[model samples]
Structures are given as structure tokens and as C-alpha cells.
Target chain A: MTLEIQNASARAGGREIVHNLDLALAAGEIVAVVGPNGAGKSTLLKLACGLMPLHGGEIRFDGSKIGSLSAGELSRRRALLPQECPMRARFTALELVLMGTAISGQGRPMAERVAIAQDTLDRVGLSSFMERDIMTLSGGERQRVHLARVLAQLEAAARNGAPGCLLLDEPLSAQDMARQRLILQIAKMHAAHGGSVLLVLHDLNWAAACADRIVVMHQGRIQSHGLPRDILTSELLHDVFGIPDGCIHQHCSTGRPFVVPHDLVMPEDINKRETPCILQ
Target chain B: MRAMRVHAGWILLSLLPLLILVMLVAVEVGASGAGIGTLLHAPDVATRNLAWMVIAHIRAPRVVLAAMAGAALGAAGATMQGLFRNPLADPGLIGVSSGAALAASCVIVLGVDMAQSGFLNGWAVPLAGMLGSFLVTLLLYVFATRAGITSVTTVLLAGVAFGAFSGALTGILIFRANDTALRDLTFWTLGSFSGANWERIGLLSPFLVLAGVIATRLAVPLNAMLLGEADAALMGYPVERTKRLAMLGVAASVGPVVAFVGAIGFVGVVVPHLVRLVTGPDHRLVLPGSALLGAILLTAADTIARLVAAPAELPVGIITAALGTPVFVWLLSRIHGADIPS
Candidate 1:
């Protein structure tokens, strides 16, 4: 499936949050979106997933306009994981995950849907937590359960012969380091299975390590989009993210550029130093 | 540690016998001294006939009506809670009971002589109550929904405002009411199954059935909705349609029950929580389990109401609130640190 966003502009509370943004995701590809806070990263993801309406332009999934497809039809082709899901009801982990398959598993048997939910939970290393109440789980654990839910949605869609897209926003924010790697690995596996993943991420190093291409955003517009090696430069970081020039370095083994903000001037020291400071 | 939750199907299956037992107990324990033994083995045929008449016509209908109203409230409560994604959301949260009460008060104070007007005798108040509830629901939808999407927060706040407005109107009608009208309004507000009969049951059945079907179909979508609206939509459930169906279901079911039996509280708010404690949060279980458990609780409460004052019956609503408060507080204490959102 090819998910395309063509010159899309999204507004929130009558003000434009995403302006004339253009991007696309093909099957078997993983694209990571990196941007500073308030850069419209989450809004862009919401627009792509049809959760937010575009002020102008349009979004299409598999050559069909998003507005043309019914919600059920669109969901069969894509799933979204928001930044945070605040659940007030006490649902078991398996029950919450099973909800993900509700739409795509309409004609499928109950056993198959349950199996898919279980499989996704197991993939996220939550096999033992299937019956645990989500309220009792820690924040990171709850986040993984939701991640499993998102994966289960796509897994059911794939089983129906329509491998779809995943639009995740800050999926790793609540996770620990190992689980973060585990989540990115799961995304990679989804891409390997001919599904596409477009995830908004804050950690530049992980973005560089996992993404096939990196898209940078600043002030609701795409600043740059290219291979990780070409995109992760000190000049781009200094311009867009206000990082110091020496912070971007190529990893010795993978040759991927990783950011080391350690020796950089802190915000308070920016005016005292000769380093160009673009942050205002 | 969490208590072991019974499987939803088993809980549903087990509730059938329990409900029957509660209904039988409710039927047997009333103000009348006639028991099952009196119906079967009275000393004379005349006495047996009297026993049978009282049991079948009076106790049976009242018990069955109580069960029906309880089941409607329970299922509606579950649906409302699921739709709002708030554990505290009650069926009455959407102004159904208040609106119905306002309309019923209007009918009573106006002294509509429907018996002479060729209308269905004694049907005006209930029909007006139903209309009032539907109108409030419609107004809420118009005010809270923009385009196709309904904001849950807006719906919640607007429902409270509408409920207060209706309550104020009802108070005005109460002020203008005569002695008889005031007494009738008082009984209606406190709620009772004293008016239950075959005809009232027939009138309430269709609305309850319609609401039940809608609530049953909403189980999966409601489960998806616990993840929140955007996520529910992404999961392929029609979020907007689900919200509309839920509001309609609650209004259709709860309206008639309040119209027929006055305004019973606590059953709608507490029964679902009780069901969730035993069956977890899956609506497939919570909905049906709620219907059964609610029937049992309300039937038992009505029996208590009947027996408490012997010949003079207490309104069942008083019993529900009196009994429901302790149980609800105990439940809160039990799940306090674990489940309640901060």
C-alpha cells in the first residue's frame, strides 16, 4: 500500500498547525519523522491517519482519497498509535489488545482474532501480561500494551491480504532503553512483512539507526528529507534544532551520524559563546 | 492482588438462576399474607382463588416490572459508562430521568383528563415523559455535536446544564400543583413499581427491547472506545455512530422505565461497577451481567420496599439509594488504590 499526503494543511482551533506538507510511505519502508516540540509532528501523523482533517489538499491511501473511504475501509489499510492513551476503565491487557482487531477481524473467527492479539502481545514481550489489568501495570508496560494493540491491528489487516500502514507518534517516550529497541525492531519486522511504518520520534540516534529515510520538520513544514547519513548533518542540526556544530559525528562501525549533545553549549551559555545560536 | 474474574459467559449463565430466584423471592414476600402454599393448599377454594389472584396479578407484575426496569437501567448504565469512558458516568447523566420527571410533573399538574379525551387511558404521562427525554437528548446532540463529531466533554457538561434546567422547570410545576397533584408528583419522584400491570409491561417492553439490541451491538465498539475516540476510529469502529447509538439507546430504554416507575437511581450507576468487579471491563459481560444482576438487585430491593412497611409500601427508589450507597462506598474502598484514576 502507498500512503500519500499531498500538500496537506491541518489546522487546530482555527490556526494552521501543519502547512502545505507533502510526504508518502510505500510498502516495506520505514520512515522516521524527527522534529522539535510544537513542530506539528503529532498533527502530521494525525492528518496521515485521518484523525485530523486537512484544511487544504488531501491524503490518499492506496490511490483512494481518505475522505472517499469509509472509516472501516480506511482502518483496514492503516492504524495509528497516539503519544499517550489515558485509559480510565480497567481492562485486561488481552482485552485491550483484542479491541485492535475489532474492525479488521469482522468476518474472521473469534479464535483467529484472539490468536492475533496474543501473538502481538507476545511480540512486545507482554505474553505474561495478557490477563493483567492495565491499571496495575506501570506506565512503560501500559505503553507496550498499546503498542501491541497497534501491531495487532496491522496483523489482522495483513491476514486479510491488505498489509497496511502504521502511523505512530512518540511510541518510545514511555519505554525504557531495551524496550525501545524492541519496539523499533518490531516496526522493522512489520516493514519487512511489506507493511509501511511512519513513526514520529524524538531520539535522533534511534531515528538514524532504524529509519530507512529521515524527515525533519520545523514550524509545521518539512525542512529536509533524505538518507540518514545525508540528513543527519551538524549544519542541519545547528539550523533546525539549535545544536552545536561538533555534536554530529559518524558512528565508527555503522557510519550513521549520531548526535552527541554532551559538549554542546547549554541554553544559558548560548549568548556567552561565539557559536551561532538560532534558538529564539 | 486482583480477585479472579469469572468468565463472562459463565457469569451470564449463572445470573439466570439467580435472577429467577430473586424474582420468586420478590413475588413471595409482599404485604399480602398469601404465599405459594396459600395458592396451592389453601383450606378452601375461595381462599385459594384469592391467593392466586393476588400472586398473579399484583406480586408477579410488580416483581417482573422491577426486574425489567432494573435490567434497562443496568444495561443503559453500562452503555453510558462505556461511551463516556468514565466509570462514574450514569444513565441519568444525560438528563433522561430529569427530563422525564419534568414532563411527568407537567402532565400531573395540568390534570389532563385523557380518559375522557379518547386517548389511551393513563398513557399521557408516560408518553409525555418519553417525549421530554427524547427532546432533551436531541437538544444535547445539537448543542454538543459539531459537524459529525460529538465532543464527549461538551456532551457531559451540556447534559448537566439541561438536567438542572429541567429540574428548575419541574420545581415550578411542583409549586403550582394542588394537594393531589403534589402527592402524585412526590410518589413519581421517589419511584415505585406499585402501578405495574400487564398493560404497563407491554408498553415498556418494546422500548427496552430496542435499547437492549442497540446496547448488545455496541459491546465491541465500546470496548474499542475505551482507548479513546481517535484510537477507536482508527481501530475501525464508527466512533460517531457509536456515540449516537449509545445516547439513543440510553434515552430510549431509561426514559420509559422512569416514565412508568418514576425515577429510580443508584441501579444505573452502581450495578455496572458491581458487574465490572466480578467480570472485568469487557462489555460483552458487563452489559448482560449488568442486566441480570440489576434485575436481581432491584427485585430484592423492591421486595424489601414492600415488606418494610407491611401494608404501606415504600418507594423502591429510596431502598435502592439507601442500599446502593453503602455497597458503592464499600466497592470504592476495595478498589481504592488500584483502579480509581488520580
Candidate 2:
């Protein structure tokens, strides 16, 4: 396994936020943690990234206890993109991305760091925003800049021969449809390159489509953990998310699961329709 | 949109000539009216002695001391703002100046006679001031930080409260002091470069250079911290160590200056901001730019303070606050109303 969390629990503000969670991610695998808001999805990602200390369990990376490694060691091993991009400084997108390499000790010349930053920005569809002040960018654009920063960190680590893990919290919440797909594709590509990914996503269909394994969390506990094709049944969705039956459908063309909230329609309106128009 | 490519090195290089020009001008236009040329080419030994006294003993030290103090405060301000991740955070916001002033007042009021002591006479006041500032900073940080994250708002509020608390104590010290000590205390509190001499400058250099160099080195970590403490740690930047180092650097930079020159206002709060306007938000650029610009500004401000009232001389703090307020207000207005979190 590339990353392992054995019975990890964490508390925030005098309350336990993550409780007795055991999960592991192997190399070249994408694991998505899906849950409602405040269900400890973000907390789990943060704990795994070592941003928060675990109260009652051991976190290991490459079979060594996480707490034993120095901060630089841990940082060179994993990159996290937090939920809120709270960067309000007047840094250009390129400058912001270059800051990611700070943990790697700035041994590379400025030109090389700039080249790496620019390359990641290009991958995130922000090649044109290299010089633009981050403050001037829209929320979505700023999120992409942070995404590019994480990607740059991972790439730098990979070049050093450590295929690090990427822990992202809602990495695509602000993007449009095309960019969302692009972000997932980027995550998949990272995993395919011998890296590991633990993504916190809210959209169930996106999880089902992108994640090799889905871990559903509720009230700070994992409710289900398995392949999406087997675990993401109608009963689990209804129990975990309050989705009624006939709402989730396996796409005929793609053969992947998708959610259609057909239960929201009024009974009289549904009866008036000869056939449902959503699938058509 | 294309990124704006600002050559920070070239900008720093360009600032050198301007700073030197200001320093030279400041050295010339003192109340003594002894120009550098006349001082250099005195005809008689007696005249040369007098000229040297004015140039070396009076003018040069004042200018150099002002430069050192201003540069220290400005760099400290920039580092503090970056460390706290708040644009409005200043070195004085954490009560360093007030604490130093309080200690110095205690020494003066209590008749410590630092200048007349056996071995520590020359160094007593500055040492006490440095200790005072360091203690307050340590206490404030202890009370304000929790679980590695420092809430910027808490630090600011604590600074204000502690400043007022120390100011009140200083006021009590002043009330009990005799006429001689009172005059000295009043002048010191108003903040002037009046007693500048090579001795005080020598006393300040080690701390100034140490803090300045450390803060400049911290530019990258400070930028990492701009993303927030947690993110900075996750990025491999040593968050706790950076915080401790930046805090120590601020105290070391500001403490000795407050001990020697009293509380020179606004240079700490204003120069870094003006530097950022030119150098962008990169602390690497901002720190060095703040240092040079700060020295230049204080030198110029001291010159103006000496000449504007001519021989009577206004306090340098009065001049900095008078000039800094308007600029600070203009900066505030430039930000959109929505930018101020409602």
C-alpha cells in the first residue's frame, strides 16, 4: 500500500470529527471518499495528508509510521488541495504555483521551477493565466491554480523518484463540466503513473464514474467500502443518501452508474406523463 | 491573461542609487548647516575638528541610526504580515514597541542609571527594552496560538489590549518620575533620533543585521504561509519553526531599536506596504525592498523633521504618522468595498 490509515480518529473544536476510520490506498489506484457535508470526508483527507494529528491510530506511508517522518519527508511524499483556496495575496498565478516547490528546498534554479510551474498550469488549462494576478482570477480559476500547484508538487516528487500521493478535497467543485472531467482525468493519469489518489467528492455519479473504489462515510464512520460497480446499489444509495428507488440508473451506453432524482417530481405530474423524458 | 513579469532584482538594483542619494542629502541638510564639502576641506585644524564633530558625531550618526531603525521596523512589518497571513498585521500590532517602551520607562523612572553603571552602563536600557519586547511577544503568542494555528484576529486584539495595558503602566511611571526623568521620558516617547552616536549604532548593528538577514531568508516560507499554516506544513515548509523564527526575528529587530530610539511609529506599518505596491506580494522582493525603502524614507523623514521647524525640530514619530495616515487611508479606499469581509 502507498498510504494506510489504521483506526484513525481525529477531533476538532472539542468534538470528534473523524472516528475509527481504516482505509488504505495502493499505488496506481484512485479511491474516492463520498459523503454528505460534515460527514468527515474532508477530515479524513486532512488526517491522511497529516495536516491534522490522529487521536487514536497510526498512519503509515510506505510501511513507516507517519508521525516518525519529518515534515519535509511527509510533504515530499503527499500533496493536499484543501476545500477552500484562501489565497488572497496579490501573487500572479505563476508565482502562486512556484510556491509549491518551496518544500523541495529551492535547489533548482528559478528558470527550472518556472518551467515546472508553467507546465502544470498548462495541464490544468491555465497556460494563459501564468502572469495574471491570482486576486483578479475568478473563484474557479483560482481553484485551478491551486490544482496546478499540487500537480507541480507531485511532478517534482516523481522526478525525485518518489511517486507521492495526492489528497484532494473537492478538487472540481468550482469547475465547469469540461474542467471537471479534465480534473478527474488528471487524477486518473496521476494514479496510472504509479501514484496514489484519495479524492473527496460530493457528487455520487462522479465518484462512481471515476473512482476505482468508493468509500461512503456517514456520521464520521465508513458505511461501505468496495468497488463502485458492486457497492453502489440502489439500497445503499437510498440508505446512505435518502435517494428513492428508480433514481439511480446504470447508463445503457457507458454502463456506469448515474443519479437522476426522479423522486422529486410530483405524483400527479408523473402520472400525466406517458413516459419519463429524462432518459430520452 | 499573461503574467506580469517584474524583474525584482532590477527593481532592487534601481532602488540603490535612490537610497544613496537620500542618505547623502540627509547627511548634508542638518541643522548645523555644515555641508559635506566644507566639512571635508576645512582650512585650519580647529575648523577641521569642529567640522568633524558636526559631520561624524552629530549628522552621520542620526542619519545612520534612523536608517537602521526604519529598515528594521519595515522588514519586521513585512515578515509579520506574511507570517500572520494578514495584510494589516504590523510588528507593533503584537505590542513589541509598547513592551519595550514600558521597560525603558521603568528603567528611567526607577533610577536604574544604566549609563553610569560599572560594566553594563552603556547597554542597560536597550537590553531591558529587548527583554521587555521579547517577553510580551512570547506571552502574546502563547495566549493567541492554539494547536499550531494562530488566529490573526486574536493576535491583533491581544496586541491592542496589551499595548493599552503597557501604555497605562508607562503613564503611571511617568507620573511618579522627577522633572529630569520626565523630560527624558517625554522626549523618548515622542520618538526622535536626537541622541544618535556611533556607540548606539554599534549596539544596534548585530541585532539589526541578524534579524534582517533571517527575515530575508524567510521570504519563501512566508510566501508558503500565505496559503495558511496547515497548507504550508503540508507543502513541506516547517510551519512551527518558521513561526518561531519569524517571531524571534521581529522581536530582535524591533526590541533593540525601541530601547535605543523609543517607539518610532508608522515606518513599521507603512514602508512594507509601499514596497509591496512596487515589488508585488512576493516576500523575497518585499522584504529587501522594504529594508531599502524604509531606510530611505526614515532618513528623508528625519531630515525634514530637523529642518521643517528649523533648530526647534519636530519628533520623527509625528512626521511619520502625519504622512503615513493619509497614504494608509488611500490604500484602504482603493480596495473594493466587498473585499472587506462583511
lDDT of 2 by residue, A1-280 (tens): 2999999999989988888999999999999999777889988988898878889998998998998988888877888999997876778888888888766534667778788899999999999988887888899999999999988876766664646898999988999999999999999988888899999998889999999999999989998899887777888778888777777778787787878777678999877998657583
For candidate 2 chain A, the 10 contiguous residues with the lowest summed lDDT are A154-163
**Could you report the DockQ of all the candidates, in the order they appear?**
0.52, 0.57
Worst 10 residues of 2 chain B by lDDT: B333-342
lDDT of 2 at A188: 90
Instruction: Please write out the lDDT profile of model 1 over residues B1-342, one tens digit for every residue.
Output: 123555557767888999998899877776779989899889899999989999999999999999999999999988888887776888878888888888888898885565226665778778888888888878888888899788988988888888898889989998998988888898899999998899999989999889988987898888777777878888889889989999999999998899889999899889998888777777888889888888999999999999999899898889999999999899888877664321
lDDT of 1 by residue, A61-140 (tens): 98999999998888788888889988767788888888888787678888999999999999999999998888889999
Model 2 lDDT tens row, B1-342: 222325656777688899889888988887767778777787877777877788888998999999898888888888888876666778887778888988888888885675457787756666778889989988888888897766656877899999999989998998899997898788778788987899889878999888977886698888888777878888888777777788789888888888888888878777887877667777878888888888888889889999999889988888888998998888777764633110
Q: What is the lDDT of candidate 1?
A: 0.87
Q: Estimate each model's TM-score.
A: 0.94, 0.94
Q: Choose the strongest candidate by lDDT.
A: 1
Reported per model, the fraction of native interface contacts reproduced equals 0.73, 0.70
Docking class of 1: medium
